[model samples]
Target: MRTQVAIIGAGPSGLLLSQLLHKAGVDCVVFERRSPEYVLSRIRAGVLEQGTVDMLEQAGVSERMRKEGLPHDGFTMAVGDTRLRIDLNGLTSGKNVMVYGQTEVTKDLMDAHEARSAQVIYEAENVTPHDFETDHPRVTYEKDGVSHEITCDFICGCDGYHGVSRTSVPKAAITEFEKVYPFGWLGILSYVKPVDHELIYANHPNGFALASMRSETLSRYYIQVPAGTDVNKWSDDALWDELKIRLGAQAAANMETGPTIEKSIAPLRSFVSEPLRFGRMFLAGDAAHIVPPTGAKGLNLAASDIHYLSNGLIEFYGEKSSAGVDHYSQKALSRIWKAERFSWWMTSILHQFPDLGAFNARIQQSEMDYLASSHAAQVSLAENYVGLPF
Candidate 1:
């Protein structure tokens, strides 16, 4: 099979890129390893930056989100036993986050793609891109125990950090920068209702915890845990006790822990690969960079990367010129680094470090204190959190 673009990985980045390109009359094929059911059922980032919501609406994927997603006006910052509310409306003039999972966004795009009769090759195995420099790059995969190849002019690697696309480029010329945190977050989705209407970020002597909701009936929450912690180690009752100690002491969280739906220990790290493109293949989303979850910027960054790549592709393929194409890497890097810095700042301000100088921990606490006290500090966070406009 031949098309204008051969996209690897059917995650949100690849799917959205295909959707945007197809809407512009570009031909593209998306390949995925997971079944449709697993892709839709996975629980991931649930907060949408205001800008992301706008772009999805313009892309015609926000119909269900608008009807079902919960929007929050602000969040509570829990430090010790004091809870300070940062009204997002007061900070950003109505900019806020919509509670909709990244998985949901992927499903929405997938459904729309199918309705348009778009080709999404699922259960595709051993997918590899070869000869990217030419107009006939190929994606080889196996299906029904038989191997096959799809040829295209360009290849897009949206398979994320663990994928081979970034490695496909020469390492000597590539520069990588990453920040790995000592701790990880144990996230759980519960059938119980959220303790509060808006999300809560609780800081304690032990660690940090967060209270967020997926819907009115279902809620999501997280607590800091040791690195490489296993999700199965904690029982439902045990998780509830820690959550209460962190979140309940402040702001009267009437949390009721129901059946545990999903639990995972997610590591905290920040990674960025420079020059997100090489030859005829480009990388986006987790394939390029990763951020700590404290700021909830992962999906938003992925959305932005694909957003820019789509525009650049339109410019390159439409006019038969490499103007935008030539500068795609540089253009994408600017935004990528800005996001990296923001994610780093938020992560550092929240999590505690062991054996640190007492001054350092106090400094972080002071910063949080200032954010609660100073409108300027709160607005700065509000801008980044609502997400850089798409």
Candidate 2:
């Protein structure tokens, strides 16, 4: 098979990239290691920055999201028992975020791909990109006990952190930076109404807790646990009891609890790979970087990467300009680092550190106190939460 672009992975990043490229009349193919059912079954962050929402609109997949996704102007944070609300829309001049699940976004993109009859090779095994440095780059994979090869002008490594694309790069050619947090988030999705209309991030003596939602009636919440915590150890009732303690009295009082539809634990990590481009292949989304979910920048960062990437591809194919394609890595990394900083800062301020003694704990408290008292501090928080300009 031959195409204009060979896209690795069928996650939101790859799917969205393919949709945008195809809309621009650029032919591309997506390869996935998992079945469609398995791909869609994975749960992920739902908060969408304004930029990501705009990209979805541009991709012509916003109808369902605009109809079903919840838009929020603000979110709450607790410092001890005091809840501080950050006016995201107000501080950012009406810019806000949408609470739409990533799964839904993937589904929409998948539907768009099918409507256009774009190619997505699912259940592809041993997918690899070869000759990326040369003029003619190609991807190889196996399907149904048969070998296949796809030659393309460019290759997009959207496969994610553990994916083959990033790993395909020689270690000496790339510099990697990473920080693994000592704790993990134990999250649950349930069919109960959220404790509050907007999401809440809580800082308590026990740990950090978050009250979020997928919709008006479908709630998603998380609490900090040990690094290797097991989901099976916490029953639905037990999880609720712990959440009530960390979220404070008022929220816990009005919060409804029910059997969890899904539960899992995700370890926190902040990672970034420099120079997103390697010859003819470019890395986007989790393939190039990762951020802790505290600030919900994962999907938004990916969207920004796609924005830069799709523009580069479009310029190459439409305008016959190599400028965007040439500078894609530098431009995308500039934005990626900012999001990474924000996510790291939020995580540090809100999460409990085992070795953080009296002085450090008081410092963290002071930061939260100032954030609530100072308009400037709140505005800064709101601006970053809504997303930095892309």
Predictions in order: lDDT: 0.84, 0.94
**Per-residue lDDT of candidate 1, residues 1-390 (tens digit):** 788898998899899989889888889999887788877886788888887787788678999999999998787776654567878877899888899888879889989998999999998888888987666688898877999998888899999898878888888757899888889999998888788889888778778899988889888889999887878889988888888887765434587767787888899999999888777899999999998988788998888888788888888788887777678788778888888889888777666666546898788777777777788888888888887664
* Structural similarity to truth (TM-score) of each candidate: 0.95, 0.99
**Steric clash count of candidate 1:** 0
Q: How accurate is candidate 2 locally (lDDT)?
A: 0.94
Compare the candidates by lDDT and give the number of the best one: 2
Clashes per candidate (backbone, < 3 Å): 0, 0
Lowest-scoring 10 consecutive residues by lDDT in candidate 1? 246-255
User: Model 2 has how many clashing residue pairs?
Assistant: 0
**Highest TM-score against the true fold, candidate:** 2
TM-score of 1: 0.95
Give a tens-digit lDDT track for model 2, residues 121-234.
Answer: 999999999999889999999999999999999999999999999999999999999999999999999999999989999989999999999999999999999898878999
